[model samples]
Target: MNGVLKALALPVVLFTGWWVLSADSESFYAPPLSQILTAFGDTWTLEQLKADVLPSLLRLFAGFLLAALIGVAAGVAIGSSRRLRAVTEPVLEFFRAIPPPVLVPVIMLFAGIGDAMKVIVIVFGCVWPILLNTVEGVRAVDSVVLETARSYGVTGTARITRVILPSASPQIATGLRQALSIAIILMVISEMFAASNGLGFTIVQFQRSFAIPEMWSGIILLGLLGFGLSLLFRLAERRALRWYEGLRAAQRSS
Candidate 1:
């Protein structure tokens, strides 16, 4: 109830304030809250929304999923193998330091400004956070536990499955959370700057059409999309790391 109230309080205040401030603004910069809501009602109608949002979501899922798989694999390999880590660590760091937006030109040139290009960009943009997080999670595993497992009959695949992965699950989850946020932002940005579909594209189209309310609706929908996705991912993270969380709490109490 307290959490519910906290969430509701901000939106109530913000919407009321926006309603007052933008009710009669002549500029597109301040569209009335009522009009914005109306635009949301129209644009977010099931048929209209499905047409616009589905494509973006499909793209987002594809790119994000691809990145997570490849990133986790690469991360595990790098984290586990000293030789691989030694060779690729600098290169990974160098590439990660560079912004994905900067590579749009090259990506568009090579891949063409389509789904393939956008998905690839999203993959490149999102993979680093996940990969780095996986490496950190793996490295942060307790040395004592590792040694004990080795002392036991646990070697090779058994040890990795029984020990390393469980130890690193928490941080990998955290990394996924971060990567998801980045992916959402990149999805909109990629669509906005490049494509002819998605919420970003719809917003651009409406803005050009001088449909202020509709444009604002696109922005609102985008916000809601990101928020909904974040909340869902957070719940998943909590569920996934419940065991680790319990262990931490026990440790604190002890």
Candidate 2:
């Protein structure tokens, strides 16, 4: 309870300040918080959420999951082989240097302006972080641990699953946390181009039609959604890394 209060303290103070300051604002662009809240309630009806928000979330999860799978698998393979890592390093760096948003146009040429294109854009943006982190993690696995596993006759798949992955999980979690934020951002960006219906689409529509309150509401909704997802990710990461956390705690105490 104390932790939660501490977490929300700054936001509550900032929001209160905004409400008080903007109470009598007359600006067309920057409406009062009360008006934005009212618009949020009116604009984001259940039907609107179904039509717009659902599709965006579906695409986001799909792209993020695919990126995770591909990144981890490829990272493991590449990290396991010196020759493969050497051969792919240049290619990986080249692609990673190119911003994912820039490739949206090129990707649309092949993938078309559909969910596939959006997912691909998200995956492209998110995969590099996961892949690089996983590679570094795998490479950084303790040699003593590897030797112990080998002494016990663990090899190949057993070694990877039981040893390498667990040892590398901390770094992998870092990658995942980074990728998730990218996924959300790309989800919005991808929807901005040739999209029929989505949060980003709806927000852009609201802006273009001069519906400032609705636009502000959409922005608020996006921020809330991102916050909720981040909170969930932290919970999941905590659960996933329980052992790692315990180990670190033990080391610190020692």
Candidate 3:
């Protein structure tokens, strides 16, 4: 309860302040909170949700999942072998340095302004953190564990599945958490660049038309969406890393 209250306190304070400050305001750009909420309630109908929200979520999930799979696989391969890591480190760094938004136009040229381009953009943006973290996690695994697994005749997939992945899961989870925010940002940026339908496009459309309240509503919805995804990810991470967390706690207690 205390934790919940602490979490709610800031939002409550901010909302109250916003309500009070905008109560008698007449700013065109910054519509009153009540008006924004009203517009939000009105514009976010079932159909709009299906059309805009669903597509954005689909792209987000599809791209993120792809990034996760590829990142983990590549990270494992590179991390487990010193030669491979040496060979790939510079290339990875170079690519990772490039801003994802810069690739949107180039990707669009190749993939066109379609779902493929958007997913590609998101995947490109999200893959680096997961890949880098997984590499670090794998490299950091205790050498004793690897030797033990090898002595037991464990090889290839068995070793990776039973030892490496489990040992590195905590770091992988961290990477995924980092990637989530990047994925969301890329999702919005991609839509803003060249798109017909999405939360980003909708917000931009409203802003262009000077529908200030509706634009604010879209922005609010995006923030809420990010918060909800974050909560869900945290819940999943807690479940997935339960053993790792328990081990740490035990060590601390000792």
Clashing pairs in 3: none
| Best prediction by lDDT | 2
- Each prediction's RMSD over C-alphas, in Å, is 2.0, 1.1, 1.3
Model 2 ranges with Cα > 4 A deviation: 1-3
lDDT of 2 by residue, 162-222 (tens): 9999999999999999999999999999999999999999999999999999999999899
What's model 3's lDDT at 168? Answer: 93
lDDT of each: 0.84, 0.94, 0.94
Which structure is stronger by TM-score: 1 or 3?
Answer: 3
Which segments of candidate 3 are over 4 A away from where they belong?
1-9
What lDDT score is found at residue 94 in candidate 2?
Answer: 99
Candidate 1 Cα deviation (angstroms), residue 10: 3.7
Instruction: Kindly give the number of clashing pairs for every candidate.
Output: 0, 0, 0
lDDT of 3 by residue, 104-145 (tens): 989999999989999999999999999999999999999999
* Candidate 1: count of backbone clashes, pairs at least 3 residues apart or interchain: 0
